[model samples]
Target: MFWEALGSAVLGLALAWAAVRRLPHRLPARAMVLPTGAAGALFGAFLTHSALGSAGLPVILVGALAVSAASLSLLLRPAEGLRRRSATA
Candidate 1:
């Protein structure tokens, strides 16, 4: 379980970093993104594992990654709106 969580965190961080790099405009700082991604992935993995009762590791990991990405995107989305509003102001 520890290794699973760590793996999920690392994967999440990498995915988050890639996403941050792909953004057309700057959003949040790396410090914020990293923790958020890690936590999101960890929580996602835990949730999937618990909910499924006895799922495979691969399934849990994939679910973790997907949820992590979705959560990060959702978290960062508000910043985009704020940026747009500021620019228009």
Candidate 2:
């Protein structure tokens, strides 16, 4: 459990770092994406752990693959710029 928690934390940090790097230049560091990515990763880890409790390695592997594929699909979707703030004087 200790190692799993440690690994999850590290993974979360890594994802957060990646997100921060990909943010647009106009965005402020204080409002950057690291926190969002980190939170998502931690939540995903917790959910995955809960769902796979006492499961065998093969089942765990399949579940991970499914989750990862879904996440990748969502991430790769084209951004509609829905979150962009319009310029206002």
Candidate 3:
């Protein structure tokens, strides 16, 4: 269980990093998803797979729903933005 949690955490962070890197340059900052979502999704997936996998429809449905909601929510957050000033330091 310890290893599983660690793996999930690593996976989540990696996914977020990948998304940030892969996001297109032309997209508005707000349109990009945050990496934390990826991490949360990973942790949620591990939980669902640990013991709840055998549970009935309700369990599966709930897990799936939660994961989807978290993952999508992260993706929906506005990407970070950068601004430029006319004057130099």
| lDDT for each residue of candidate 1 in 1-89, tens digit (9 for 90 to 100) | 77678888888898888877876265477778777888889888998889885587787888789888887887554444564545557
**lDDT, each prediction:** 0.79, 0.49, 0.53
TM-score of 1: 0.77
lDDT of 3 at 24: 44
Candidate 2 Cα misplacement greater than 4 A, ranges: 26-32, 54-89
lDDT of 3 at 48: 84
- Give per-residue CA lDDT, model 2, range 1-89, as digits (tens): 45444555555556556544664443346243444444455555556678877554444434443443344334433455656666982
In Å, residue 43's CA in model 1 sits off its true spot by 0.4
Q: In candidate 2, list every pair of residues with a backbone clash.
A: none
RMSD of each: 4.0, 6.9, 9.1
Model 3, residue 54: distance off in Å is 9.3
Candidate 1 RMSD to the correct structure: 4.0
TM-score result, candidate 2: 0.48
Q: What's the distance in Å from true for residue 62, model 3?
A: 16
